[model samples]
Target: MSDRMRMMVVMCAVALLAGCAGGLGGGTYERAEARRAMTVDYGTVESVRQVQLEGTKTPVGTIAGAAVGGVAGSTIGGGSGRTIATVLGAVAGGVAGSAVEESATRKRGVEVTVKLDNGQLLAVVQEDEGEGFSPGERVRVVRDGRTTRVSR
Candidate 1:
């Protein structure tokens, strides 16, 4: 494979990943932050449980890996050996890439158990990109539809 083709494969991989990625952690998606987003839950944070934010590895990662692997494998040999290498590379790359993408995108998240003012306790887990919330800190749980965020 030529350098140009390899570049294309990489670019395509990046573009594909960009679309499926749900963002590193927190951000308003498709909806304005204040649009119908009311303070659904106001509480004192009882605990901030640290957890891993697993990332989704769909077809994008697999396809991207296969493309790059195929390209790389094509350079291995001529005739049948090349063909076998390409196939093996694609399979290995797909698996490895999926894992790599997932690992790369994995982030720090927290299961925030809040003590609502009404004496009821509920836990909301969301990605924590440094949205500081300490135990006993007052925070707001804003909700719009199925989406929710914990913020100071």
Candidate 2:
């Protein structure tokens, strides 16, 4: 394939990989969570701070990048030179792809330390969906068996 075509494929793959990312914010929910009973606790926000939510590390990004790189590298030269280029390109692309995916999916998060009505203190971190929290604000601590989130 032509260099342009190969580049287009790579771009498309990256886009698809990005689309695979889902929100980690308080408002977002997985399908399985629908109608499932959850526990809720009332609390006052004791402290609110900004944090970074790390990106996902999935095989999809590495594999897609390697494939795109191998195809692009194959067009570089003839015979043995092309083979070496493909191998090197794949390796580099895989690393680059992983980084790109992580950077692209990374999000700003908030760490909310709350003082529950029961006198217990707990902290929860979740994507900062722009609904800012402040100290002394009333919030709800929602919990499922697997996860927890602080919401207003």
Candidate 3:
């Protein structure tokens, strides 16, 4: 690949990585009216476990990787040999790019088990934003649509 083309691909990859980091982060909640606000439930955290947060895997990474890889692989040989190398490189690069995007965007999170005031027990998981909830600590559970969060 030409230096110009390589530079373009690198820039594209960097842009995609920045975009992949979008969406929810720790310690932030959407603001809504009282009626629209999440329904609140009270409980005590019974246990906590650290966990890995999954990042979104989009087609951008695969496409960028394939483009770059194909160009690089095309330099390997002539005609049919080049074609075969390009295909293999594209596939391998696509997979590697997807994995890299996921890892780079992943965040640290925690799973919390709680016991409700009504004797019903529950567990919730969320990003740990320095608001660590220990066992037996009082917590409030809130639900907005299908998403729920636990807070002090």
TM-scores of all candidate predictions against the true structure: 0.84, 0.93, 0.82
**Total clashing pairs in model 1:** 0
lDDT for each residue of candidate 2 in 1-152, tens digit (9 for 90 to 100):
78788888888887878786898898988899999999999999999899999998888788878878788778789889999999988888888877877888889999999999999999999999997999999999999879898888
List candidate 2 segments past 4 Å from native.
Answer: 2-8
Return the TM-score for candidate 2, rounded to 2 decimals: 0.93
Compared with the true structure, all predictions reach lDDT values of 0.78, 0.88, 0.78
User: Number of clashes in model 2?
Assistant: 0
lDDT of 1 by residue, 1-152 (tens): 68998899988877776666565344545545544645577899999888888988687788888888887888898899999999988898888778867876677888888888999887878887778778999988776666767777
Q: After superposition, how far is residue 58 of candidate 3 from its true place, in Å?
A: 2.4
Candidate 2 accuracy as lDDT: 0.88
Of the pair 1 and 3, which is ahead by TM-score? Answer: 1
State the local distance difference test value for candidate 1. Answer: 0.78
Candidate 3 residue 75 Cα shift, in angstroms, is: 2.6
- Model 3 C-alpha RMSD to native: 2.8
Span of ten consecutive residues with least summed lDDT in model 1: 23-32
Off by over 4 Å in 3: 22-26, 30-35
Give model 1's TM-score versus the native structure: 0.84
